[model samples]
Target: MVVVRGALVLSLVALLLGLSAGPATAQGPKPTIVLVHGAFADSSGWRDVAANLRSEGYPVQTFDNPLRSPAYDSGQLEKQLATISGPIVLVGHSYGGFVITNTHDPDVRANVYIAAFAPASGEFVQGLLNPITYPGSRLLPPALQLKLVENDPTGIGGRNIDGYIARPYFRDIFAQDVSPAVAADMFAHQKSAALVANLEPSGAPSWATVPSWYLISTQDRVIPPALQRFMSSRAAPGRTAAVDASHASLVSRPADVTAIVLAAATAVQR
Candidate 1:
């Protein structure tokens, strides 16, 4: 519940995003900003955010996270990180945060979570499921719709399943803060994540050693704002910010999200 304003307000983005770091980087080049999207959405959701970052002269790449198990997805992201040079400011939104939590990428100088899940060791991002644990979260049954897909072989048989936010509840749960047109567009383009992702337990969180940041969306109907506060506090982030936006604040308020990313990037560049 910390209030940030003026110059210090800018500094809070790193802590708000739940990025906890040990030491400042020695003189180095600007780190590449790598963004990971979460469930029910695709890289397209980051279209505005990436454009803003690139406009700031940052090298930004929105990773098309395969909506699979955390372990498998993290492996994919780790491989992608290895191909890129220099340090990285790894950012994630929603379940994408769950995926990033499992990575141990050394080049990742800072972690920025934008209304995303930042789970701890052995913690499942599915913690969102407990109504008692995370009050006010409406991302539950009925609001969520699951579709079965074949040819995935990684399921309980030779089939797979994906979860999508029901169209009727999509705006209410994920993007109530945005305009109807934008929210509808987002829903139209949203991609489903593997339902098994909710079942996978997170490994040792990378934020512990990589320095992390968190941006909590106060009006978030997806993940409770209380949960965001809990996660950010648990991470012991060096900086943090609370925005009165929805879970899709990254869409309605990309600037706020970018401020946190910039703070993390500046911290790593130092």
Candidate 2:
């Protein structure tokens, strides 16, 4: 009788302890961060941003955007996402925004756009700037200022071609706020984006369903600040921050970009 009573008491104690400890148990694994660079820039642009994220204890990955068609680039990114086991915070800059828009990966917990093109369904990067009749359209005559270095015939329908910013215009348009020396070096190494990548229409934007954040670069000459504001408002992102940096804010203002990315990462933790 005494043994039975003791067993019952012990069982009750164990149940109470389990219930009390439930909320204190470990949460699931942390989400990994995937940084996608925009056109003309390589993964090297994300070096500072990635470093900051890693310092914050985040598992970071930087994907080199092929600057190909939206569908093709997104498809490639989707493959990379498949390799990650935990949740992801997918971040895109400039043309990279269009790539992430097409990705409907289930593991993406949040989307972050850094002075990028957040096109809606049926809208392409060119279409966004094509309608701009005013002089404020920074990208209207991008080809004229960008020097053509290569004529790679590997793009979609052989229509897409690559071009880099001319040394003279590189500092003014792409990285206005960056030092002259750094801008020159960046211009020298800048990869030419396939022209078709900007012309192709975006599929259903993942931002439509997933939560989003935007880091608008007010001084951005590639994608104008007004356009960034318009797109960000249209998406109704969870958070929006504006910085005084240029289009290369990822490199010029890494801390600001890192903060917004970290916010998205922190939110997904809850």
Candidate 3:
């Protein structure tokens, strides 16, 4: 009787172990969707899109972009990426695209660009804008009305520390399609990006190796729709879409942005 009882106990342990491991093997791991915001905007810009993704049962994470420079920002993001296990679908907005381009975490399965700066290897944001001469191009046309803040503590020969869009032009330039009330609020809380960040060259572009999706904002005045199209063409073939929204499309058109993100997440699952 003792021998029979011991054998049964061992079998029960094995059964329990098998059951514990069953789900992981049968369904695999789910990919986490990470949303990154760009210059002049905080993580709050992704609030709507994040909510949409969460409603669909996707684990969503929104990172606060340093907006200091691509290398520094990407380094911070890399540390965050290390904490997440399984696959990742990285989505970037505006200057966040440059940050994502510099990050090549192996767990990243796909990259999504939303009215964002998609720089090639060694290409800086300013360099991309040098050739664009569109009528409503915010970067040019009497130059961006920026309030430059100095970084020097002693206040002697201090270089420009950061650049904030002048409140008066923020709505017309960045969020023309958004409502006046929301645009006013957005302008009020907007953050300043280090002026040097735009001139900093990018490292190897992750989109070159990872699958990518681009959502060009047709009415984008900041990056310009023409520039968006040119960048989208260099991405993985046939992985592009467009929306007739302003530069803040992620905020103004959250549903469309969420749909594209979900498509990337689905692709990663397969």
Winning model by TM-score: 1
Candidate 1 structure quality by residue, lDDT tens digits, 156-207: 7768888889989999999998888988999998888787798888888888
Model 2 residue 70 CA deviation in Å: 0.7
Candidate 3's C-alpha runs over 4 A off are 1-28, 131-136, 140-160
By the TM-score metric, which is better: model 1 or model 2? 1
List the candidates ranked by lDDT, beginning with the highest.
Answer: 1, 3, 2
lDDT of each: 0.81, 0.77, 0.78
Model 2 TM-score (2 dp): 0.84
Q: How many backbone clashes does candidate 1 have?
A: 17
TM-score of each: 0.89, 0.84, 0.83
Clashes of each: 17, 0, 0
Task: Give candidate 1's error at residue 264 in angstroms.
Answer: 0.4
Clashing pairs in 2: none
Sliding window of 10 residues with minimal summed lDDT for model 3: 17-26
Instruction: Give me the displacement of residue 149 in model 2, in angstroms.
Output: 8.1
